[model samples]
Target: MGLLDNLKAKLNPAKDKVSGLAQQHGDKIQHGLDKAAKVVDEKTKGKYSDKIQTGTGKAKGAMDRLAHKDGTDAGGATDTPPAPPPPSSPPPAS
Candidate 1:
């Protein structure tokens, strides 16, 4: 294999492990990101609120992609919609 191919092969396992961890801990990771953003915003006295919000959104988007929570299939298309809730049972007669 070429140097790039060899490097990719060596890193593939680590990448997979990281992806799995991201999927498992996605909620916690997102919470941490929000908390950190809040702390930074507070420290800066809201001076960079807009910038911080933008960065935080981008970070969350990246996390979702990493965790496969972005609704994208293996083909990279998001054509599938979320499943609907089951119908509720009818009320009993009086």
Candidate 2:
């Protein structure tokens, strides 16, 4: 395996654990993000409100991706698993 591949393999377990945690505590994590952003915005006297909002949105998006709640795979595909085909009707007897 290449260097990047080796690194990814080593980090896979940690990544899974983090994803699980994110999924479990997503609401709490998002609340914290909003709280921090609000505080920073207030501290800056709303001068960076837009920037703060953008950053917060990006961070939330990343969290959703990590939790696989964005309905996308690693390749960014939104394709869901194919459903089973319906059973065919039997032919009439001769």
Candidate 3:
């Protein structure tokens, strides 16, 4: 096996364990993220409020993805389909 493949195989178990833990404690993890963001925002006196907010959002999204809350397929890409756009009017009868 390739070096990367071997490394991935060895890490799979730990990754699974962490994924399970993330799913179980996602709320707590998000809370901690929020708390940390708040502290950092305060420390920066809102200088980077937008950037911090963006970063926090990205972190939470990553955590959700790791926890499989985003319905990812085996390839780790989201399997969920985008919502269909609303029709402006009913389609004309054929």
lDDT for 69 in candidate 2 is 82
The digit string of per-residue lDDT tens for model 2 on 1-94 reads: 9999999999999999999999999999888988887777767777677777778877887887788887887688755432222222233244
Any residue pairs clashing in model 3, and if so which? none
- Model 1 misses residue 67 by how many Å? 1.1
Q: Give candidate 2's TM-score.
A: 0.80
| Whole-model lDDT, model 1 | 0.73
Clashes of 1: 0
TM-score of each: 0.74, 0.80, 0.80
Estimate the TM-score for candidate 1: 0.74
CA lDDT scores, all candidates in order? 0.73, 0.75, 0.76
Per-residue lDDT of 1-94 in model 3, one digit per residue for the tens? 9999999999999999999999999999988978887777777776676777777778888888888887988886787643222112222344
Task: Output the lDDT of residue 36, model 3.
Answer: 83
